[model samples]
Target: MFKLLFLVLLAASVHQARPDGRIVNGETANSMAVAPWQVSLQTSYHFCGGSLISPTHVMTAAHCYQRFGVTVHFGSVSNANSPNVFDVSTFTQHPSYSTGITTDYDYAVIKMAQSASMNSNTQDIALPDDTDYTGQTAQISGWGQLSGSGGTPTLLQVATVPIVSEDACKSQWGNLRITDRMICAGGAGTSACMGDSGGPLAIKDSSGKWVLLGNTSWGSSSCTTNTVSVWSKNANQLSWINGQMNS
Candidate 1:
């Protein structure tokens, strides 16, 4: 069965779960009405999170892209009540993305059938620079589940977690390959759980502008477990992302 790259449901709830991840531990419902760039990727039967990087481009994890069919929804926090829906005209995943084998290079970009109209509820987020974000505080937002048996929430969820150093992440993950292209965050019960995959893991820079640093990728087998959640490093792939948009 094709699964969302990061989702791992409770063994008992497997049959009833949707392939997804959510913010666990230190999560709060987003109080504000607008997360301008936040978007939802709805497939024929399931959904994933994403971020709008431009009027015509949405950044997400490669695994979230369903070649069969996908639609992008913006301007709403409730996945079931999104008012703006756009058909995906095309998409491109990292050249190295492969299913069930590697999580490296798990990023992708989607081109909408029509450009999104910028409004108070819809806008693009800035990409990150070369500065290393280790130790920096970052925020992750998604509509993923609150618990293993708990279904995903209708309201968007947000969490703040510090970026974990590569050394510590590698030490924790042990035999698992922890590449420089990946950024580790949220351990000790706080993490990006099922359904959060493909959503932006962003940081507010010195200028107070939120810069996208990564996107939810994969994590431990359970949301309640103490594990380092891994994200696709956005800074490392900026060149590739720009090249695709410009080409």
Candidate 2:
């Protein structure tokens, strides 16, 4: 599984200054529409991100954890808030994770020392049972910054994109090696970018539950550019995700 490169939004340079004055291409906002406790993984020392999957487990790109020591934040999206930062006790990247090549199994989970407390504002999203998300429209929500040149939003941002065929995605990417473990979303000129990794790609299931179908992964540099999202929907990995969550 290839760790997608973090693309910093170009707009962030104007609104805020990162610690080292390094501009990251992605941004996110704090919004009441999303659960208040839905956390974004961040670090004072690193650039990658992660998502809170359960009260205690965070699902994120394996490389994000490997590259930066795992640290999860809850209750608030800003670093100013006093957050409970827990070191990852253990993590399991897909056994076939590849360093240089993009693979369908670019997913991993981190277990924290203690479980997160649940409330109306903090809860775990459900996961789909199988790879049955053929033509469903899903909503991806994140506090990640917007665009490669913008500032992170103060409110959580939510976008709706339809699921696309893997074949079509491969065609868009000049027939790159798109595997069954992945799925594509966004339009010809819209998508998720940096700081959005490990976020949920959720759709309403047959029971009307917002079940997670994919985790935010790599895409093109710009939202206006055609981008393909690599997901963890491959048969074996999907099973593992469900099994880990006991879904």
Candidate 3:
């Protein structure tokens, strides 16, 4: 039931019997071996995507923290058998987050019941500096559906998307209220869908290190080739994130 919408305003709500599908124009199948920081979140009712920010902390969309009983699965691509499952000790979402409106401040932090074992298969992703990323190339990974009518994939999926400027993205979203706290990427045939919500939008820095840039927030319902996907800008919320993690 992930990302099965056709309208622009609905965004993609992929949380049902099925979670989400593979990335568009991506590998038929990929392994978590590449994106060790990527994570899968299991709620009492459904699944959402997430990223490992620290040994004991995960970052995802605040909207994804619906009810209690959330769990984090690490070191696996297949949703069927996530080798490592960690109970959530506590969670916190942005103070100003609200559903059905613009998702400008959609962010959340989850502390694991215990610290995750740091190894090659499970590691933390680096957060970016306070630099601009309007024209950078980023990677989006998820298990969302391949198409509106498609099924969720067994293996994790990923795709490369170009970050678009606020002016360009605003023109397409029209009145959707694009804010500086949000980053727009993926258009038309290339975008993140329902199941992909709360996942990471990461970019490689000049030093070739992956930096977390955005979090999957919302996109066109149709998952079409022309719709721009919206993400929560991580750089804009670094101070808030640090405050929560430090507290």
TM-score for each model = 0.87, 0.76, 0.88
Across 32-64, the per-residue lDDT of candidate 2 in tens digits comes to 235443455656633344556678777766545
Best-fitting candidate, scored by TM-score: 3
Question: CA lDDT, every prediction?
Answer: 0.74, 0.55, 0.74
In terms of lDDT, which candidate is stronger, 2 or 3? 3
lDDT tens per residue, model 3, 1-247: 1231222343333311111323565554356757788888876423688899999999988767755788898888786688898999888999977554465587899988888888777889998887777777788887777776577776788788888888888777654557878888877357677677788888888889988897887765656656677788999989999887888
Tens digit of per-residue lDDT, candidate 1, span 117-158? 888778899889878878878888887777655677777787
Cα lDDT for residue 43, candidate 2: 60
Question: Which model is ahead, 2 or 3, in terms of TM-score?
Answer: 3
Give candidate 1 regions above 4 Å deviation. Answer: 1-20, 26-34, 99-101
Query: How far is each candidate from the true structure, as Cα RMSD in Å?
Result: 4.5, 6.8, 4.2
